[model samples]
Target: MAGKSGKAFDFSLFRRLITYTNPYRLTFYFVAFSAILLAALSIVNPYLLKQVIDKTITPKNGDLLVYYITLMLVFLVVDVISQFLFIYFANWLGQEVIRDIRVKLFKHMLGFKKQYYDKSAVGRLVTRAVSDIETIASIFSQGLFMIISDLLKMLAILGYMAYQSWELTLLVFAVLPLIVYATRVFQKKMKAAFEEVRTQVSNLNSFVQERITGMKIVQLFTREETEYANFKKINEKHKKGWIKTVWYNSIFFPIAEMASSIVIGLIVWYGGLKAAQVDGMTLGLVIEFIQLSQILFRPLRQIADKFNTLQMGMVAANRVFAVLDTQSVIEDNGEEELIHVKGDISFDNVRFSYIPGEEVLKGISLEVKSGDTVAIVGATGAGKSTIINLLSRFYEIDSGVIAIDHTDIKTIKLKSLRDHIAVVLQDVFLFADTILNNITLNNPNISQDKVEQAAREIGIHDFITSLPGGYNYNVKERGVMLSSGQRQLISFLRAYVSNPEILVLDEATSSIDSHSEQLIQDATDKITKDRTSIVIAHRLATIKNADKIIVMDQGTIVEQGSHNELLEITDGYYRNLYEVQFASATTTE
Candidate 1:
């Protein structure tokens, strides 16, 4: 069920997975050596039994018998030690390989552009980074090495049996084709059954994860009973898929056992008849053949199942490599580095779209000089937020130039470009961590004292101290424990502490309460005093005092002027929007 695709064995993918083990070549060699040693030890017991019964017991030499027994014990101890070394180090190699692969996968993902995440599923990535990578470990521990060990043991057993008695060897393996055929059939059926099983499990798990993450919506819409019924149907399908695999296993193993039992019976009967006919034949030879038969055939029954583990690793490797090979990363080829930003920002005929052929920003151009607080006011979907996104290089511009400090932003390195700008988004997202860490994002350069100072500048310091643990308080996931207004305040504090050269506020104060609005307003004034700032405000009253106001509609700027200048223009876009959005507040003030 864990294997992806269930496709024919891909040698290329297998080699790619093996590349992860190159860093531990010596350990791989040791494991291979152990497999060979274990195979050599497998036939020692049968050979010793033959020697004791024929050479010592038959002659009634007690000293020779004791010596042979002691030798047998010595080989038995060596066999146990070899087995322990083989298992422990094989598992160790599997673990180390997976650790390196998982880390590489995650680091590669970190470089992907935001557009990739907009179209990707969080749960799917989690599975690739977690469970899929885990399956690769079994390739070494249970799949490849163990299969080699078993096949080698079979070959060694056959070699010894042929040397001892060709007649006994031929008699015992007469049923080999039947057992092999049964195993092949079992493997085919199990593959299809497990594929269905995994499909059902994925459907079941995605349903549960989605429902739980949106449990608020479920209860609000009274869908608990409906979701439960849906879950039961998925669970039943999952169970049936598993039962089919179980049925195949139950049928196959017994057939193999029957074949094994028949071979042993044939061996005993033929060896006894030969013993009566030839003076060289002895009871000890028949006993040794019986022991050797079990040793040689037991792993044959399991070899097919072990091969499935290799198939799983190959399939997982294919999936992981697909992600690693994705071309969704933003090009970071810019050699120009920003040593100091002077906060001169501009967009010249900039255009962009989240989806091709549907432009979100259409030939929009604007400018904000250093130390100017410029406000962008527009209706929803008016491209106000799109401008800020392009400025931060979260998404590259489609056909225009965005610049800071009179230099093209595309010419600046991404880290250097982003380090000078801090954006406070409307819908704040905070980690499940302490307020201190959330504000600074655990950057070693930003100390707790710096965060406290930023909070004070924003007038949120007293409110933070009032929380149970002060700045040390944990916000839980997405800051769910805090109110919408509190989360916004924390986000503002986060941006303020960075001391970026350019500050972008995308409706950051839209969700704040009346009390918090005053706090944020004061903080906004203080934070935007000496910095180049662009504020996207839905509430028209918040930006009345800005040095310049830009009014946009449907991805194009309709008007630009000072607050009073735009207000006085009769039926101007800014004047009309301002009157409608804040008419009641204007009267009260």
Candidate 2:
């Protein structure tokens, strides 16, 4: 799927797109029926013109002229109504298909492994889910239905022209091969151009999204000018991609217009000569052939432009389908239903690497009893956080087994397994919503009363009520309205409410004030009282009371013991780490 080539007018891709319309098959049928009616009715206007010229006007019969005009007016009404229905249903079908695809694409993305997101750009995904899908909508609204209607109209005009005079029709048909050749070349070139355009669009979206997300870093480093210069390069590339399409349009349309003019001229010259030489070939027949030539050649000229719409749509569809077709690396084959877990966790010689050939966690083994509180202390890049990530099954380990209650974690259903575990990271993310909504995460089963009671148990109830709106306060994006310590307290309350059998806190109070730290310490005791708790912390002072402390170096656990037991060792890793890491915090406190 990654190496697939883009082919212009891929029939397989077209067939796949058609299947999405099956849900709206009845509306689609109405659109088709309306297009057919419009095509058939359109020919009546030119036929009426020929009748007025040859039968009514030429003979000077006012009564017949009035009757023919009445018939033309009736056809006009029907044509207008048919056109309206064709436009309405075609667009409606397009909107509905895109809505379904967008929902499906988002749902698929939600199931992807964390590693997929590590390599994917947010803006690139946004373009696929939003911009690209909208472009596909045009394939039906402006491309497919319109092209079909035009082709039908052309066929109807060609039939009428042949009935009027076979020789004149043949003359017009001679120049068609030239127009067809031009269109085929135009489609090929435009498709390649459209593909470039979509790529550039994704690139531009990715760059802007990244810059905006990291605006704080940009401002802190004063790299505004440098970043703006880089953005201009991407913006220019996007511009150039569109320019290529414009250049192709400029070359193709004139050639088509010229070909159309030549056909019309040929009709006038050859038909005029034939009318002069023959008896039945009247001026009325010559004029009707000329009018019919415009109808036939006009669509031919416009088809090239319409094909551009279809081509752009195909390019967008190719991108969107590429994402939809991506199979998640994490396969959830486990059918084990875990109704309850004892929270006993064991790592048996687990080896893992985020990237190939670069091991982050080497062959490591550890165990925590159902009710034990274990603290993992390590320097940056020592694989402390990786342990938590692996335990939560955010990424699969390369080798060995991770078990909960002697049952392999891989054999347990992902949702059910994760349901019994809750994590609080150093950096907490809160959505722009009421604090109560953030705590419950909109889970209808967790009522406001339940959340308030949980907050009180966690000992943050007084702090929350002190805020202007209490638990109903709007946090704004990422909880910017709250202080760092307040946000940490909110996260603790959130995790506590879940009432998980296992709780993991990674540097939960590392960068907070003493007041917040004291509150978190009080809350942490309440939350981890009976549950299996894993605390990954850089601040050694925070974990002095942990039932067991494991000191990690590089990817291996070098020491494990109680705080007093580890302190008894004169030069052990935990003793040295406590002096180097916790001395400052202890003095500050």
CA lDDT of every candidate: 0.86, 0.89
List the pairs of residues colliding in candidate 2.
Answer: none
Tens digits of per-residue lDDT for model 2, 1-589 = 2114555588788888889999999999989988888889877888888888888988899999999999999888888888888998999999999999999899899888888999899999999999999999999999999999999998988887778778988888898888889889888888888888999999999999999979999999999999999999999999999999999889988988888789889988987887788574777788888787788878888888988999888888888999999986566778887777788999999999999889988888999999899999988999999999998888999999999999898988888888899999999999999999999999898998999899888888998999999988999988989999999999998899888999999999989998999999999999999999999997787889999998888998889999999988989988887777667766878
Sliding window of 10 residues with minimal summed lDDT for model 1: 1-10
Q: How does model 1 fare in lDDT?
A: 0.86
In candidate 2, position 476 carries an lDDT of 94
RMSD of each: 2.5, 1.9
lDDT of 1 by residue, 219-322 (tens): 99999999899889989998998899779878988888888899899988888898878575788889898999998789888886786676556556666787
User: TM-score of the candidate numbered 2?
Assistant: 0.96
Top TM-score prediction, candidate number = 2
Q: After superposition, how far is residue 144 of candidate 1 from its true place, in Å?
A: 1.9
